[model samples]
Target chain A: MFKRIWGWIQRFSSPKHFYDISGKMIPWFAVSALLLGVYGLYMGLFVAPTDYQQGESYRIIFIHVPAAWMSLFIYMVMAIASAIGLIWQIKLADMVAAASAPIGAWFTFLALVTGSLWGKPMWGAYWVWDARLTSELILLFLYFGYMALQSSIEDQRTADKASGLLAIVGVVNIPIIHYSVEWWNTLHQGATVAKFDKPSMHIDMLIPLLVMAFAAKLFYAAVVLVRARNEVLMRERNRQWVRELVEKI
Target chain B: MLKAFYHLLARDLRLAFRLRHELANPLIFFVLVVSLFPLAVTPNAELLQEMAPGVIWVSALLSVLLSLDRLFKQDYEDGSLDQLMLSPNPLVILVLAKVAAHWLLTGLPLVLIAPLLGLFMYVPAEANGVLMLSLLLGTPVLSLVGAIGVSLTVAVNRGGVLLSLIILPLYIPILIFGANAVDVASDGLSVRGQILFLGAVLAMSISLAPLATAVALRITASR
Candidate 1:
């Protein structure tokens, strides 16, 4: 049974097979992400109760929390794929890792911007030296570094291996960096009142946040598939199957 | 294996000695950076003292980064890297030796001079010892981690900027702990925890970074 599953995965690893499979799957992901996104936004923005403490500005949590989750989630995915690519020499996995970088970066940027907007009213500033915010900023830098390294190398294979190594290294350091920053932040600021609105999450807010997070993940899947398909086409352009597929398209 | 490691370390040190200017550039950069802060920021001793830990640590980190390109590029250029790869000894041992040599040439100098830089920055006299201790524990980790980046990009001409981009994020934890140790000490607080964290990071990097560096070197060199 294991061998059979492994054989299936091996077949799916082929660019042509992956291209066909992803084409069929991408629309499902896109449509689900769209439906979920609309419902989530409506519920999160309109239905959730206003925070008595933070008032309407707290609504930014709907965007900020989900984006931050995606930022971390996407990096985890990228790093795992990178490790697989490195260990197994799987081109498809490398392509997936490469495709994940920009999407992850966008999520990280969204988290930062939305968090800053939330902070202005709550923390009385556009930015704070809070541990969470600082760590998110570092994560953004990591994504940019991965992309920069990828683009600098001319050869696609070399770029994949090098950036994959970097992604793995960055992932390993993320937790340590996050904790160190947290420690440093607390040490420097001895008496700042911690006002991060961590009230008991009601179901109304929880549902939408969870829905939006799922939608963001589905969106990642749809976009990564699209990008991975493009990578496959480029890498396999000279092959007969790809030529046929391109001609058909 | 031990003999081969010694030979590789000795050879790298000899070459570094012969190319004295390359060895001096990063030290010079470190001094220039630390000196510039007084002029660029403020000459106020109190303010400088407060900013001293962060300024010195950042300068040392950047100088280490500035010197990373020389880690593997010369050997790569002169075709000795291929020969090193072909050697019967395990690549990880050889790479570790190279990284050790790199730390001696670059990191060790920074550590030794950090106390002097701290004085120049007007750091509290009590903090100078902590500053030197932090750098001593921290710079080896920089060399070890920086070796991975240097190995990855050794084949690519003019990868210095790319190298910085990739490695700088990985250096943040060390920077945080190292700077904070001195800062805490300057504030007359117990810095034992920060010192312990730096040592842990150093130990972890020493054990793991060489293996990663060896793999990266093999990957970059194979092509």
Candidate 2:
């Protein structure tokens, strides 16, 4: 089974094959993302009970948490994919890495805005140099940096390798950014869900958070597939397959 | 190999010194930036002291960034970099020698002048040790990491602003610890812990940044 799956993965490593396969997956992913997102929102806002501490205002977590998770998660995926492309010379992997950047940056921006909105009511300030928030801000800068590096260079192969090295080096800071709160006496609250022994939050809250996380993963898959297809088309525009495919369309 | 390394380092230093006008630009920028705060804000002594460490650190960071493009730009343009790459010596050693020369020209001067600038912001004498030591340990990391940004963008036209856009975020951790070390010392707290952490970060960056920078140079050179 493992060998068979590996064979399939290798076959799909070609940009042409990946493009065709992702085209078929996009609709299915989109529909499921829409359905799951709606259900997740419904469950989070209405079905979930109000927190004793934050009350109704805590509903922002539904958006904020998922956005934050996606921001970091997408960056990790991009960096890993870029690394694969650099090491394995996989063209499809580079396309995925390049395509995922803008979407990840958008989510990072949303996370910051929503986080600030939440902070105003809870922390009584629009912003503070809290470790988690500051790190997230830095994450936004990292995304911008990656995109800027890729776009500034005209040569495609050069851009990929340069940006790949940067991505790998910048990955060292991610853990430092994430754990800056725990390591220091930061104003940001400590972990609520991810803990050593057990989660600190109640079950009612945990379920919605998990569902939203799953929905976010699905949403990322759907959007990444769509964007990757476009990227492949743009990069492969000079190829014969692209010409034939464009003529067919 | 040793002969080539020393020759490159000595040559870079001599060339940089001959272009003394360019070498002084960042220092003058540092001074000008430090002076701007007093003119813009009210000349309140307490407020100035309060903001001094952050202001001075920020100016130092910007000055270092302003000068970093010079690290590889001249060599890259005059094709000296290609010759260096084709040399018998390893590129990483050449990179290290260049970074050291860059530090001598940029980072060392910043460290020496930091105290004078610190006085402009009303930084007290008591914290001078922290200020000097942090810069001593931290600025090499800045030169090393900034070299990576310089190498990556050196081949591109009009890469200065884009280089800063790529490098400034990466510089935050250094800025945080470097500035915070002084802050802790000024407040009569023990700063040894922070200093040690800064040293560790510096060591890590020194070891890793040159390899990344060498890789980046090869990538840009390939085009």
Candidate 3:
């Protein structure tokens, strides 16, 4: 089992191998993402019952919650990839980490923008220093820092290793950010969907939300794989496989 | 290991003392920036008192950031950083010693001078001790974590702005707790929880930061 996993790591790190495999996977992921996203949106907007207290404004959670979850979720992916890259010196893991940063940043920004739009009607203010909002803002800053570090260094290997270190460090701080912000204020509503017991959300609302979240995950998989393909091409432009592919194209 | 750590630490301290005038820059920056709040915001003592903890803590945070150049730039320029890296001793201990020297020269002075700034901002006398105590606990964490940033960027040309961009986000939690402790203390509330958290963070930074810094230095030096 260990050797198979190790062999998988070896094959995955080969630029041609990753490029070809991810190329095949992208269409599948993209198609699923598009289909699920449309279905989820239709269900959430036209099918889910109106929120009793929050009314229609609460429907924005379909986008906001999934985007917010993706923001944190992608950061975890980046961190884990960074760890793998750093520990085993797998170049593909580093590329994945690098590619995920901007996507993660965009998701965080979407979450914040949609959150504030929701806040305008719900809290009667566009922004608040609430724990969830504040920590999410800090998460955005963490993404920016990661990207900045990646770009400033010229050496690709050094950049990967350096930014990988930074990602691991940022992950360590995420929990600290959450706790500190929570201590500073607590105005945000408590968890609803992630509760271990039956979620407070009605089933009609919950199903679409889960579908949207799954769609977002698939969407990220598609986008990151595309970005990782570009990374592989850039790094391997002079390699034999890339040269042969360029000639064929 | 102990001998190498002590020697490197002593060497950094000695070098810091030789250029004592430069040591005052971050302290001056700290004091100067803190004094600006009254002129810019308001001359109202009550308002100043309200802003005191945040003002002092933020200025101190920036001051520590500005002084981070003192950690590795000089050594890198002189090629002594390579020597330190090549030393037979473990790099983590050497990095820790350099950070201790940095904190002593830069972070420690902020802690020493914080009360004077606190007084200027009308921080009640009761909170002064906590302000100093928080700085004492918080600033070393800054140097430790800041070492990781500096080492990562030390090879980049013009890394000053990038350093702050990358480092400040990491610095947020320390700033939150350190500033809030003073905020809580000024209100005559029990600050035991805040101090404990700061202490916990300090402990974590101490254990982990130097290792990260060492790895970062190796990456940077690989060029």
Q: Using TM-score as the measure, which candidate wins?
A: 1
TM-score of each: 0.98, 0.94, 0.97
Per-residue lDDT tens digits for candidate 3, residues B144-207, read 9999999999989999999999999999888888888998899999889889998999999999
TM value for model 3: 0.97
Alpha-carbon deviation at A80 in model 2, angstroms: 0.7
Cα distance off (Å), candidate 3, residue B139: 0.6
Candidate 2: segments with Cα more than 4 A from true spot:
A1-10, A177-199
Candidate 3 residue-wise lDDT at A84: 95
Question: Of the pair 1 and 2, which is ahead by DockQ?
Answer: 1
Model 2 per-residue lDDT tens digits across residues A81-145: 98998887888888888889999999999999988898877777778555667788889999999
Candidate 2 backbone collisions, by pair: none
lDDT of 1: 0.91
Q: Which of 2 and 3 is ahead in TM-score?
A: 3
* lDDT tens readout by residue for model 3, A84-137: 999999999999999999999999999999989988877778885657888899
Instruction: Give Cα-based local distance difference scores for all models.
Output: 0.91, 0.85, 0.93
lDDT of 2 at B34: 90
